[model samples]
Target: MVALSNVRFGKRNDEVKAIQAGLIAVGMNIPAGATGFFGEQTRSAYAAWQRVLGFTGSAADGFPGCSSLAELGARAGFVVDCRNPGAITKSSVRFSRNSGVAVDEATARAFAEQACDRTGAPRSWVTGVSNGANLLTLVFRESSFRPNAVNRDDVNATGPIQSDGARLNCSRGYAQVIPDTFAENHQAGTSDRIYDPVANIAAAINYIWRRYGDISRVQQANPHRDPAPY
Candidate 1:
């Protein structure tokens, strides 16, 4: 079985090779063939596959979504594990406005871009569901760009006090995620500390991908819409 996380852009692994093989099996051209690297050639081939699957415009931009990737895995005799550990019922998560010491927009954008790189999300230039700008907006709405922001009065604010002087379950960091959410969606190779800007943003991005499909669907991430719980 191939994990969906391993099949995105910038990722290089056996799962990428499997995806390349699948693309080849379906007659998509890859000059380098199954190189295990998800570069321009693999992206183009995947775009072709996406087109064949009836996706167009931004959907066929070669970035793998769970449904499309799963379909490819099925056609290639493999199973895709699209399981999302960050899956949480929206109703169970209450929203509250919280703020802390703020950073400039440029610093926040830099952190958000790092998160995009780690999570296979596109930067601002890419037109798609979730991009770096979307993440920046979400982070701003959630914590006002504060990496150490914490919401101690929200519904998730129960539990023992943590090292950061907040309850263990309080929404913390730039993305305002509770401890459980952070732990569940934490990106590999990132710090376990919930206050780390890049790690917090990456976890939030992964959670967004699983829960809402993309940041575009999140009201807080949309500039024109009134900020709401995501």
Candidate 2:
């Protein structure tokens, strides 16, 4: 499963090395420095980054994944031009519109599509739901999802779908995944497990299925309370 490919697969050989170097510079990673080969050491380094950041799920393998890059970019404030990506921090949306990194709607949609496709969810629905909204890639922003891959960068995390960096983990891509008590309840279908994005997306669709069956019930159940600020 870790062998899957995304845009990150097309990174130039030097870009791959730069990622390793950046991870190492932050002191939480020690991959062979992106020898242009995504091997175990790189994977371990990524896992280390997750652990440092306190991501909830498994460690990040050194496959040069977009989620990893996007999260790190968010942490580093790529879009907005911030500095330093710790496991957690007290920065605002660091990513700026000027960051050399790409931050366009089309890119966001592609990433969201990739996430949906991999999770086996309906890309059409996900895209429709997130359309035109401020979107960002969910990378290592979630503490619950970051612990295993944080390396030694002294990164920190808040809770599920929580972070204090660039808001790029906006409500768009997989990074914006939100799981509530209702999600947990509906997950009884052996679908979209909240913890696993793949399962969560599937579960999300199933969760929305209630609209036809019991949608009104769901809306009535959870009061419209604004989520806590990140």
Best by TM-score: 1
Clashes of each: 0, 45
- Across residues 100-169, which tens digit of lDDT does each residue of candidate 2 receive? 3243445445544554454333454333322221112123232223211221222222233443232222
> TM-score of every model?
0.63, 0.28
TM-score, cand. 1: 0.63
lDDT of 2 at 98: 18
* Tens digit per residue, CA lDDT, model 1, 21-118: 99999899999999999998998998898899998876677767788888998899889987654444332333332345358678888878888887
lDDT of 1 at 29: 98
> Whole-model lDDT for model 1 versus the true structure?
0.75
